[model samples]
Target: MDRFIECWNGLDDPRTGNAALHDFHEILAIAMCAVLCGGQGSVDMGLFAKSKEPFLRGFLRLENGVPSHDTFSRLFRMLDTEQFRAAFQRFMAGFSEQCEGVVAIDGKVLRRSFDSASGKSPLHMVAAWGCEQRLVLAQIATDAKSNEITAVPKLLEMLRLKGTIVTADALNCQRAIAQQIVDQGGDYALALKGNQGTLHDDVVLFLDDPASKAITAEPVVEADHGRIETRTATVATDIAWLNKDHHWPGLAAVGKVERLRETAGKTTSQTAYYLLSAPLTPERFNEVVRSHWGVENRLHWRLDVVMNEDQDRSRLGNGPHNLAVLRHMAINVMQKDGEKGSLRGKFKRASWDEAYLARLLSLF
Candidate 1:
């Protein structure tokens, strides 16, 4: 808690002299606590502050006696987004251990944040997900005109990914991005699709050719939730035979994964390829590639389903972006909480049990 407070203190106060009645740190503390306990909007935050006044007073001065819902909305809108994002990263750094497993980078849209008056579309945020820990490491907001490609480098620049394996979808499979990962002391496992024109064709031809000497692995089979699935991954490390015309930076090998699924007597099959900088075995390559989906499942899905982020309607100024950060922080807090049943269950407990809320806050 002390470390988080210190980090929050580092943010530049957005208010002018004497214009602020409430302490900036206290406001954020209340806001974060509210979100951790499943408060969705500014009104919910205000109500939470009022209901938990005693518990809040124990730590916070509450000098102004819990700012109004309007105050909460205004403060969040007035907050400097870049500084707030940096502070969030710094705050999360205290809890982040050494990153070593698969780190997947992806983007999500705040669906209802578009403002017709301001002529703004929905906000697009690129997030980095820690697959093994099931945690969100960092995020950045991108403009509607631009895509994740531009925002990805900025997000990568903010993270410390030494010894970690980073993965991304085909949109991010650029030569410069590959080089950036390797330059940052990390390895890349980027998906290869039609975007890479000739390179994609070459990979497909190489994998399909029976005469080609490629390393192959036995198919992995699984049965779960009334479905039977089988996956087979193949890696071709010997890429020197390819034409020298298309030179990919840090490219060590190419891989292909075939998925066959059956349900209710129906069957389907699909194949996907990847460009890898890490010299992983065929099996490990499959594992790393499969782990990339954790970003969609663990982070994006949870935010929409569990936290109701998609249904949230806070679209003014920095409200959408800042609230997204708060939601990320809440997820991290609940995930760190020991003896958790479900995320929703933990949130309910935090709301009703002050002791549990205190324990959650203690994780700092």
Candidate 2:
């Protein structure tokens, strides 16, 4: 809590005048706590504050009592989003482990946050997920997925990625983005597609060529959910001949992964190519590829299904983005809580058991 207070105080409060009653720290703390207890928007946060007044008072003074839902909404609307994100990055620095494994960068949309009258599309957020630690290190908001190509560089600048492997989809396969990762002392494994025109075609041609075969590892197979899948990964490091035509910065090697799947009497095969900065074995490349999906299945899916992020109707000002930050904080705390039950169960315990809630929040 002290660390949180420090981060909060570091922010330049956008509010002025005698009209303000609730402390900024108080509102932020209340919102975070409430969300951890399964509270959704400002109304739910206000109610949670009222119910947990005594528990809140244990750490906060609450000189003017709890703020109303309107107060919560208005303050967040005017809050400085960049400052809020910086503060979150500072606060999370305490809990982030050494960033060594795959750090997957992905984007998600706040579906219900669109405002038709104002001509505002849904908010798209790009997040950095630590696959090994199961933590959301940082996030940035963009207007669309195309904007992610630009947002990814800024987002990468906010995180400590030295000695880490960054993975992204085909949308982020830009040469500049890959160069940015390398410049930061980090390695990249970016997905390749026809978006790069001849570069993609050349790699596909090389991997398909019988003479270019320089196999590094064996294929991995899996069977589950009434389906059997096979993945064969190979790395080609001798790109000197190809480099004469397309000069990619820090391009150590190119990778190819072939997937074969059979389910319900249907069989399909697909091949994916990647640009690599790390000289990885086929086995390691396969692991990194699989870990990239963790951001989708673990973070995005959980937010939509368990945290109900897409259903949230808080699009005013900073409300949607700020609330999303709170959700990320709540998830980090809950995941670190070491509870044997599911996330929904943790929310239930936090709501029903103040002592349990205290224990959970303390982990933050």
Candidate 3:
């Protein structure tokens, strides 16, 4: 509890005059604990506080009694989202060391956060997920999906990327972004699509030629759920002529992944391209490419499916972004817990067992 208070002590309270009945950190603490126990919104936070007043008072001082639902809602709606995000980063850093291995950067839209009456669009957040740590390193909310190009650089500024490989989808394959990654002492493997126009076309044309002599890795075949899939990776490090023409920053190699899938006896094939700052072997290239999807499969999917993040209707003020950060904090805490169980099971156990919840809180 002292650690939690110290991490969030710098947040400025939005309340003024006599409106500050409950301590700000106390409200945040309650919200975090409630979320870890599967609480969705302000109402759930209030109910959890009232029900767990005794458990909470063991660490917190309830000088003015438990704060009402309105308090939680109002504070969250008015809180500085940037400050809250920074506090979360600091809190997580206090426990977890600098991230290593593949760091996947991606974006997800909070579908239900849109307000029809107010002409508000769904909130879109671009997050950096540390593949090894299985934690959300940092996130920045964008006004729209297209704004991810601008948001990605800002998100990268918040992380320590030295010696890590940062991967992103084709939409984030900008020269400036690639340069920024190298500038931060990290390498990048960004996907390529028509968005890059001539560059993508040139790579495709060159790799399709027989004389390019790109090294190919052994095909990896998998059978699951009545589907059989095969993936073959090809890498080309002899790109001196290509770099001479393009002058791409840190241009060391180009990669191609050919995926063949058979479902219900129908076969389909797809080819994808990538720009890498490092000249990795075909097998290492395959590993890096496959690990990039962990951001979606492990982090985003868990938040949306397990935590019901998309269904949350928090459209007022900074409520949506702030609540999303709380969900990230909950995931980090649960991921760090050594107990053996699925995340859903942990949520159930934590809510039912106060001792287990205390143990989880002590992990950070």
Best by TM-score: 3
Computed on alpha carbons, the lDDT of every model, listed in order, comes to: 0.87, 0.87, 0.91
After superposition, the stretches of candidate 2 with alpha carbons farther than 4 Å from their true spots are none
Candidate 2 residue 297 Cα shift, in angstroms, is 0.8
At residue 47, give the lDDT of candidate 3.
99
lDDT of 1 by residue, 299-356 (tens): 8998898889888899899999999988998898888776849888888889999999
lDDT of 1 at 96: 83
The stretch of ten residues in a row with the least summed lDDT in candidate 3 is 90-99
Q: How many pairs of residues in model 2 come into backbone collision? A: 0
Q: What lDDT score goes with residue 354 in model 2? A: 88
TM-score of each candidate structure, all chains considered together: 0.96, 0.95, 0.97
**What CA RMSD would you report for each candidate?**
1.5, 1.6, 1.2
**Ten consecutive residues with minimal summed lDDT in candidate 1?**
1-10
How big is the RMSD of model 1? 1.5
